[model samples]
Target: MASRTPAPRQQTHLAVLIDADNAPAAIVEGLFEEIAKYGIASVKRIYGDWTKPQLGKWKQVLLDHSIQPMQQFAYTSGKNATDSALIIDAMDLLYTRRFDGFCLVSSDSDFTRLAARLREEGLTVYGFGEEKTPKPFVSACDKFIYTEILRASPEAEPAPSSEKSTAANVEEAPKPAAKPKPQKVPLDFIAKVLDDIADEDDDWVHLGALGQNISKLRPAFDPRLYGFKKLSDLIKGHPKRFELQARGATNGGSKDFYVRNAGIAR
Candidate 1:
């Protein structure tokens, strides 16, 4: 019997470019953490006029996070020299074909065309910006994440109100409840994609393969956006709509997870 050859190790290498002028310094920690979920950040660079006092906060954190600050002095009063510098560097990097993807961090719509152009060359583009970022820019990338979501405290919860109980207390007006977050990835969408990609004979799909299909179908589809850390956990959340099964691995030592539409008979 011949020994089986191990599968090739495939990992995505990403170039992270930040517009320090438009993005906040506080989100740097969360931004990198989020990027790690997709792949390793091979190049981390931030473009801005480092001499300006406004970027002082960013300067303090640059060395700590190992982010390279590219200084582009203001050439004119109104024209944005930082944007031009970042764009030029991005194109240069793209031509090198050293990165599998690029992470463009900025709320400015000026980078919208840049993101689109990168995607045209068959490289994945992940965008990070504030919620107010223009729709055109958000839609241009393969994935877009709001920076506000990154800076949010995962353990933080609404504080309880304190009120003194008194005999003279009258009926108080009802306070409006906080609005629930809208589902970023709809259950229907997941189900439809699973059904479309499932094997006809097997009637089941590997959870890993399903995730890839989902990304291809909806470039911005991420489990984190829906409050789940992993795709398996996300599918498990919708137990009624999907069925998960654990089978022995191909090597016969461990287990592999698979899923299928709940309505489909095993």
Candidate 2:
């Protein structure tokens, strides 16, 4: 005789808020799939005016996904009440202590404070936005998912234009114009790390070390700009450019170690 056991439930509760103005309607489907990876999305709300013609596409998405639409009529031209409403709701949710994490879906930098505030209350914040999202908002979250890449199937998106972020939300502020194309990765510093590892007889330096080397060489280096998160994820995405390996721990800590080696491919 055998007894069946109940399955354990995922401990995370995610609240997903989409800014209709900044997010594409088509990303709705891919959005859910991405959220499922983190946890069950118990509270899903989209802020915008549903009666307007501009929101027609999103109306169908809301109905299909059973997302609650919070209607906020545009108070003035070129002004969005959506961001304010979402922030208010986020604070309310934060006080209730119900959600384990908050998913802020918007490319607008307006929510940067909201994300940071939520984290201040000890809640994990997962942000979903376009590549044009401001660095402050992107870095404020525990993790940020670029919706464009997730929407696209297998084929990778072209290299991020150096001007994308600055040109994105021009209505918000003025930014520097783009310059001519430049080298993708700073090779000299990368070469230094590789040489250092070579001198030590280490086939691979910890990805952390590699990142530090890169940062020390270039303070502005960001894996997100290169289409990746962790150094390991970035390295894995560029199989031809670099080789990765799991390295032995230094002491009793079992933190997974990653190593990178030069490859001529890309």
Candidate 3:
């Protein structure tokens, strides 16, 4: 694979389309707020029939958020036209090549294919949905966020459960007032992913490149599993087994990745 430029701090342009029928209206405000962290929500559109009484709450939010409402009335019981409209617009926008990423906000698995298709074109797809969403759609996105996490209000107290909002949101059960560190990444598993990538790359590999390779093999393989935000932080926590370099002292290129030795295990 050809090396690409480092990811920009801001997303140049992003297309955000919502399936109004499947998503709760209450999350619209926080949803856009979260998307702003990646890049601008350049194209904001929501698809569903506005005439229905069930969607009245969404009308208020649509105007507040400046989301264009695409009307698609249900032609028959149990039929959904909203999904079709959202998918059509997504494809149309995708062909223009004007956007850097896509945000598909809906709990229904109907858009799973859409998410997978967008990823095939190398677009970063960020999916937002409720906890009830199926695993297939959740795992398809480059990053999948649960609506509950985004919608968590400041006043709302945290709920006690072992459940997680994202596939990578693994949290252990709460203990009796004693806080434990997040579970550490299994050294064996890390070695397997690194060894596999190294074997494919003739015994030498870039740490940054290896991380991407690991993501391809397992979307939920996050450094956060061991309580660190970046892969470098995780590797540093296990430095005896890994080697790293700050790559940019000699040139303008940044040293943002690392490399590993083969056969290193826990």
Candidate 4:
């Protein structure tokens, strides 16, 4: 009998397109950090007219991050030409068949259709926007990241002269943003999901597989939303509802985590 060779994992290539008017310049650092988790960002582009004063802050950030700028003049009052420019470029990029995924950055709902179209072509689409973004746009992507989670911490304050608004509105004060309180974790919902995926073995499941299943059911499900940096921590916090076990790695790497319903006696 011959030993079978394991298939190599394919690297994901991503094209990150930002709507500068709707996405804040402040999220540049955290945005890239989060994108790195999924794949390499091969194309980084921001679309907006440089002639506008509101876009001035983005200029410095763009140069620092090596993101190419797409100039699109606002041809008519109350009309957004940037969206059209981005959509056209997205279609062109899609036709090339290079990128494995796309990360669309904007709070505007206008890009919802573009997101859906990209997914229709069988490419993964990740959306980055503010919490105020419409549900239609949020649901259009494989995953959605809120820019609020990407902002620099309040403790990392800069000199008075350096303080500036990097948000969409570009508020003059640059005050520490007041975020909403963390929402209560839906333990019942999680238990229900676990029950559906569990086998005859007391509903136990590998944590990684559990997370993937949860993502399939709720695209926007993230532990960060509950003030927990990691999913394990989030589950640990709810000791009454869930149980965890850390299985040592055979290769001396990090321990593997598993979770099961606390209600069941093993």
Count clashing residue pairs per candidate: 0, 0, 2, 0
Better of 2 and 3 by TM-score: 2
> How should the candidates be ordered by TM-score, best one leading?
4, 1, 2, 3
Better of 1 and 2 by TM-score: 1
Clashing pairs in 3: 207-258, 247-255
> Which model is ahead, 3 or 4, in terms of lDDT?
4
Would you list the rank order by lDDT, best first?
4, 1, 3, 2
Off by over 4 Å in 2: 1-10, 152-242, 246-257, 261-266
Candidate 4 Cα outliers beyond 4 Å, as residue runs = 1-9, 156-173, 248-251
Span of 10 residues, lowest total lDDT, candidate 4: 157-166
Candidate 4: lDDT of 52? 92
lDDT of each: 0.85, 0.75, 0.78, 0.89
How far is 117's C-alpha from truth in model 2 (Å)?
0.3
Q: Give the TM-score of candidate 3.
A: 0.63
Query: Model 4, range 218-251, lDDT digits (tens) per residue?
Result: 7677888889898899889999999998998878
Give residue 140's lDDT in candidate 2 (0 to 100). Answer: 80
Q: Give the alpha carbon lDDT tens digit for every residue of 130-209 in model 3.
A: 76788898889887766755553445347755564544675655332122245657777777777777765355567778
Query: Which clashing pairs does model 2 show?
Result: none
